[model samples]
Target: MTTAWMNATIYTGEDFAEAILTEDGRIKQVGSAEDILSSSPDRVVDLNGRFVLPGFNDSHLHLRHLGKQLQSLSLSGTKSIQELIVRSRQYLKDHPDRSRVALTGSGWNQDQFSEKRFPTKEELDQISSEIPVALTRVCGHVAVVNSRALEVLGLDASTPNPPGGIVEKKHGELTGLLKETALDYLGPLYPELTSEDLRSQFQAAFSAAVELGVTSAQSNDLSGSNTQALAIWNLLLDMDQKGQIPLRLTQQLALDTFEELDAFFEEAKQPPSDHLSMGPIKLYKDGSLGARTALMQKDYADCPGERGTDALSDESIRKVLSWAQENDRGVIIHVIGDGALERVLNLYEETEDPSRHGLVHCQISTKAQLERIKEIGCYVLAQPIFFDYDLKVLVDRVGDELAATSYAFGTLMRKGVSVSLGTDCPVEGVNPLPNLYCAIARTDLEGKPDGGFHPEHAMTLSEAIRAYTAESAFQEGHADNKGKLAPGYLADFVVLQHDPFQEKPDALLRNRVVMTVIGEKIVYTHHGERSTTR
Candidate 1:
């Protein structure tokens, strides 16, 4: 099926072009308006002078989490413990059928609280002691649950904290908060939903993604420990092949044990499909900044004595790296603090050059670490959404001194490092436009700080585009097909209302997706618009 899109300006992402024609999911030719129509044998579109660029690809996202969060009560924007309780109570009142409440949300700033504290078990218990409530922090690295939820899971102060996770306590009693590994304590009580339930959530997430010009995304598996996540991913893949999957997904399985890694590598010999593929092997080196557990060299500006927690031992990382290097599998490590960054950098330098492994949240890095990262040729899948969400928290965690260097996208790129942008969805909201806007404007979502945090590190408009598109593909090892608009590439692209380059960076954030086409098929179009395929 040949669909000609002419009379428009196309930023081929490689060259600024006049127009292009797409036939059978590949760019037929890129030329002027008159040239593209001469041989057209199918439908044609009058661009009416709009911008056409490669579709957005979120290199790091959590599709399952996105689906699950859609159904869970969201408390993302709550500012205080009181605000969180109020929201939870309201959700409970609204959804009277939900026996066990999992109030998961993302926007709380531990430093911003007037009490300067995390939500306590006592606080959650007061809201509804009978009903269980588990509220996650903005970072998704920790959560606070009521006593009832803990009781349902048979967890108490005596329950040992799992490796890489912690259970918060005060005065030698459980505080009703779990971090990293200890989070498993709340499981079993919240019964696992059926695959049908999960499918509905995934469909909701897929719909939300396609509407925003995301034809494809990667599920950066951080929460799942075993092959259980991969099982779900494989199911999604089969669905995609049958044309039943709503959106394309790349599964980046998080490694919990060497045995799991071995099993995945054995299964990695298969070819990738239009729907699903094994993406990367994710590793967690440290915790998150919001929880004040991001292994840092210096103590947090607000919380002293705690540099951060290290999730993995050096020996373990080396063993994993040895296996991945030998098998040629991609790696994605979560590193937020400088120490965490330095640790991973050392491992990367020791293994291979330009390893192409991803640093999930390379939030803080020093010149030496950046230089090493450049030398090794690793990629940074940085989340600009955190710019607005974590600026204050960052400043508090690392103090103004180190916070100034956090989320250094432009600086890293100028220094010859490959940097890609992502939402880290469910942790950061699942929107690419807002992140693209932040990349250029470097401003917070609320347009705060007047000039944005460390404005010097802000990326240019073109640079931001590449970071969102090409750079992300490069990080995922799919640059040949995913990032650019060119021949032999997936005919996945988004038609926007205006040329984002012509408008102020902040304005792009407010822009909406007009059309999203995947594999040359119009999967999503603005309501009331004529179908391109019809």
Candidate 2:
């Protein structure tokens, strides 16, 4: 059936269109309402001049992980160590029958806490001395678990440090702080979710993405663990083939080693679904700035003589990159610090990047490093929302000089580097509006700091929108058809209550998704009712 959404202020990406004609899940035409109406469409829906744009494409996120986070207890904005303890206890008290074997929660930032320090396992023990309690830092790189958890995992001061990870110890004693690979290996040791439950989680995550106007995502759902990662991948492919997944998902496979990757290449089936396809491999090079585990050239401003943890070694990463390039695929590594970027760059210098490898966070770097990135034609996927949290503690973490060049996405764009925007959801929330606001305003959701934080680094309204849409699709090799609202493009667009082009930046924070359309389907309407009259 053919349909025309007429009388709408539609941003057809490059320009505006008075009406859009869609048929068979693709745009047939975009022009003046009179011109489009002349086509004699089967149905007409008058939009009364609402703001319409291409549906958002979140460049990077953890879909399976985010789904799990939705079910797990969240302590995102908890501002005190005492509050962290209290919330964990309260959640257990509130839900007596949730999970008895292990209690897991995330999103606790030590910087925001009143005590201004990492919560020890002893503190987590207050939640339950019987059950293993593990609370991850907001960055997802660091986690603090109770003594019971350590015992259950058979980790102690006597245990040797795992490669690419740390079992953080102080004064020759166990601190229950696991950084990088240690946390990754032990994180899945908790009671596993059933296949049925995993399906539900993915559905929940997809619904949340669609509700926020995200039409597609390059998600890193597969963990480094071999068996579980492959299982989850197969499940996702099955769901995609069955049309259970709503949004387009390009998987960024995370295999722990070359052997695991080889096993995957040999055993994995190529999915036939358009919505589910292979993306670049994801490698972790460092931890996060908030966790004080991000590898940096200089010692942390707050903690003298202590740079963060470097998760990957030159030897392992080189082998993986070689494997990826040889297999005609790309790799996007998680590099958050200047030192980490340098380390990755050195490897790229020795390799031939036919698929153009990328840096996930490319967040902290010098002007020279960014210039080198541009020189290498390496694209970056950045989270502007990270700036919102960094604004308060940046100086304390990286000193003024480094902080100035850090998170400079605008600079990268100016230097001819392709930069795409994302929320890195579950690390932040999966809301594109707030992430867009942070990109445009260079401030937090509340619009803090009079002039905005590093205002020069802020992207314009059009630039931010493009970064979230066209640029995102471009990065995933889908710009030819996805991330645009035009003739022949996918009929995916969103109607917004507020026009970001004309309204204040804050309006984006308060703006609502009036309608979200994917192909011919109206998946979400603001008022919980579909109202497209024929």
C-alpha local distance difference test of each model: 0.77, 0.85
Q: How many residue pairs clash (N, CA or C atoms closer than 3 angstroms) in each of the candidate models, in the order given?
A: 6, 0
Alpha-carbon deviation at 440 in model 2, angstroms? 1.4
Shift of residue 51 alpha carbon in model 1, Å: 1.8
Query: Residue by residue across 1-534, what tens digits does model 2's lDDT show?
Result: 899998778997789878899999899999998999899999998676688999998989998878888887889999998899999999888876665777888888888898988889889888899988888888887889999998988888898778778888988888989887788656544676789889999999999999988888889988756777788888987898789988888888888488888888787788886678888889888988877788999999999998988787878999998888778888889999899999998888787862378889888898789789888788889999987787878778998888878888887887778899998888988889989888888886767877687788778888888888998888898888888887789898988877888889889888888888888678888875345567
Using all chains and alpha carbons, the TM-scores for the candidates as numbered come to 0.94, 0.96
Looking at candidate 2, what is the lDDT of residue 483? 81
In model 1, which range of ten residues has the least summed lDDT? 98-107
Which 10 successive residues of model 2 have the least lDDT summed?
184-193
